[model samples]
Target: MQGFALYPFDPPGDIAALRADLRGWLTVNQPQDDVVARANCWASFDAGFSRALGAAGYVGMTLPARYGGGDRHLLERYVVIEELLAAGAPVGAHWIADRQTGPLILRYGSEAQRERYLPGIAKGELYACIGLSEPGAGSDLAAVRTTARETAEGWRINGQKIWTTGAHFSHIMLALVRTEEESERNAGLSQVLIDLDTPGITIRPIIDMAGHHDFNEVFFDDVLVPHGALVGERGQGWKQVTAELGLERSGPERYLSSHALLAALIDAAGPDPDPAVASLIGELTAEMWTLRQLSMSTAAKLAAGEDPMVEASVVKELGNAFEQDMPRRVQAIVDCAWEGSDDLARLLRALLIASPSFSLRGGTREIIRGIIARGLGLR
Candidate 1:
């Protein structure tokens, strides 16, 4: 009936029902103690709230039900996550674990590994953080110098990871470390699961411009993890991490991190906004809708058991650009006389402070563009 079929983005009735249920639950259970703090949205780490979400069976919706997960489709998970972020719920505590780590374990971890971690993750009791970017290797993961050497006891890890968000509060770290020195860059790397409380490990806080301590520098000094801690296989880290980054880059989180601020901007601008303000809102909303479709397409691919690496990179690159641009656009449009209603002023201020990090986190714009170029065979 058509030359080209429309790509599906709208959820089915069942999925719509799931979204409604989650929205209702959030209305009843979302924290009211600090609205400004909640404005951080997905970045607001609240362990107690995380546990509550887990108790509601909302944490690990896509993993195997045997591991205490809901065993729902990835699209369903996407629905839940987007609703949570849109509501400005505190999902930071279990975000990484549920989003990528659980899936990583399911795909590559041994049965024992999955059994050890998946249940707790589904329960939202065990928190995990990614130990990817280092001081010297931010987006260039191939330059990672953190080394895990073979020892009689196990693998002894020694190195530092920077910009490890939620590291301080997390129970475990899925760290990418170099297991071989002779191989070329990206060939010798491996991922290791390390207990954050292991001896000789240090976590130093890195306060952001907003004075938030979400990011941290984690140092491992002769820390020994059992051989069982290795995920997938040694020297296969580059492959594993590349897959994980696709998961990291394409989620609703990439685009929705600043959504609370966008909502606040609209609320502050009021119903009948100026032409300039209306134009700004219209542009941002259109961009967000486009990005959401792209992101959901990627999620659908994941549900279909396909890796949308190239598509994910595209979404991330564009989404990061839009997110980073939003704060400045709002600042330019809004009048200085328009003081916000409720916590709009505070959320706007926080968004301004945190905007600089939009392109840096996940992957830098330069790095993302490079990935896009490679994907298009333009490199």
Candidate 2:
């Protein structure tokens, strides 16, 4: 792969004050959930907390004020996200809407669509799920088989989307479907914004190994949505979805999702930890710092309106390795019992169960590496 340059993450205005203000808000508003829940905290759903955070002007920080947003800088939003992740705030309820859907709609959806969705999204009262993966497609988005035929009245959608995160609770879904009858691969595919409550749509939960209902299988049979539900140009879904993946992959969430475990490990180790524990802590800290720099650079490139697909893949790949390795490494060296109820042991157990899905979610490791390889002109 070619060398990647780091884009400086310099957000304008008083960043320190922003962090301080957010930290203060979190101190009062953040939930006192189980330490295990804090480990992969982004997936911890709390609707009330989401609404409160939105009311505090932290949910839709980057969108325009007319859309119920703060009209804040992208990097400003980045700082808020970092703080929220670090504090282990329950952001899952509005996470997809605030992070990607809101922006995607602002960029591609019609004015009417924007007016209908953006305000509720910014208020953290509306949620969205991605409708990309199908039964056999998985991360191979080009292989999607969901068909949406254009009808006189509207578009009729018929297909099943598997592994749809938050679909059970989300208000809407930005779905990729075959719009043209004879289209192949990525061709003739289009994005449609579907309301989850529409008729002929069924969302069944897919509980994870950790016993969490974060994933779901959504079925659509003759589901019809208005023509205006289409996002951006028809047959441009691949490009739009690629851009959305960049946002999904390059965030602080890539590394900070497992931060609670690190914090718990440190607390359990105490100041005078065993040499092995201290060494492991140092190693994990270094990896996290490196990931933060890479993720921040990718975010900066994105803020400047540049596509950082390869950079994002690199971040996701490395971040997944770091996260998946953390629990294993801790288990190997730490003397904590697997079934123990202590904070460190509980976090360790939770993360170990959760880490397996880290690489699989954004994109599989092989797929991500292939993207990076293609970026390097090696494909």
Candidate 3:
């Protein structure tokens, strides 16, 4: 809440025990999904697994019990998420909300908002999506032109949002909209809660570079929402959006999406690591570890309620770069007979093909660099 809470980011010595516990739990609970289903990665949504996590009190690991959460430490939550990514869990369904939307609502939403949203969110029954990027303004959030005007009844929203992850299946969207006039583009933005199924709202899937349909092009055509939908004060959206982005960027998931592929590569290496292969793996793994530590440290800052946006941007950029290498190095070395499945070769191939989107989807590397520079007070 004050600054990047990452200062005391290191996990407790009991992390090994936590890891063991998580492993045992997952061993009993990991969905027995078909390899083809698994290849779709986050596409499955895995409502069953999600409900299991909620039942285990693992979904809302860091939120207050008052909201039906587990009330665990922030770092403990980090451990769960990190393990999920490493194990290649299907987490895309509640990813954004679990990571930040729920917290964002708790921090900024009114009492009624909390009462209505928190329990469902905590139970993994409700899902959240973000509505920030637009057709021409993906990374340049300040360039948003979506307008919400107050009406006698509520607000009427009209604009189109692109690259909207989870919009198709999400219950709600934390939409960043223009609420007032601003000489500076970023100044008048505001975050609002928009119901996905509301009239005048349409969501069509957008197949990303990897030929996956996890994202969407969402259009708001005179969509009406109550004034209560606004998340915070009308003029404070920029700050809220930045806070959300910080939470989004600084997580183990950023660098570890392709970790399963990396493990597959290692397992395929029969007896000994080839000298060149070892160097490449070493380079990637070393960088991945560094990025992960940086990310976890940033998460530490966030857990303490700090902006840590600058730190997050640094980690995202670096981790994204490292993540991009999974496909390249795997392709160059491994003679795989498969693409992405139970077969190690197939898994490596899919990861390689999906590598290009690694840097683009979450936040473009360029946007991250600019944020880092701005964080350093550089123009």
Q: Per-candidate TM vs. native?
A: 0.94, 0.99, 0.92
Model 2 CA lDDT for position 294: 96
Root-mean-square deviation of each candidate, in angstroms? Answer: 2.7, 0.9, 2.9
271-345 per-residue lDDT for model 1 (tens digits): 999889889999999999988888888777766777777778888888888888887787777654244555666
What would you estimate as the lDDT of candidate 3? Answer: 0.80
- lDDT score at residue 238, model 2, on the 0-100 scale: 90
**Positional deviation of 175 in candidate 2, in angstroms?**
0.3
Best by lDDT: 2
Tell me the whole-model lDDT of each prediction, alpha carbons only.
Answer: 0.85, 0.92, 0.80
Better of 1 and 3 by TM-score: 1
Tens-digit lDDT string for candidate 3 (114-226): 88888888887789898999987877778999999989999999999988888888999999999885536888889999878889998999887667778899999999999
Question: Model 1: which residue pairs collide?
Answer: none
Instruction: Judge candidate 1 against the unseen true structure and give its global Cα lDDT, from 0 to 1.
Output: 0.85
Question: Model 2, 1-379: lDDT tens per residue?
Answer: 5577889999999999999999999889988877777888889889999999999999888989898989999999999999999988889999999999999999998999889999998898999999999998986779999999999989999999999999988999999999999889989999999999999999999998888899999999999999988999999999999888899998999999999989988988899999999999999999999999999999999999988889999999999999999999999999888899899998888899999999999899999999988988995
How does candidate 1 fare on TM-score?
0.94
Model 2: lowest-lDDT 10 consecutive positions:
33-42
Model 2 residue 115 CA deviation in Å: 0.5
Winner on TM-score between 1 and 2 is 2
**Model 2 TM-score?**
0.99
List the candidate 1 regions with Cα displacement exceeding 4 Å: 1-13, 337-342
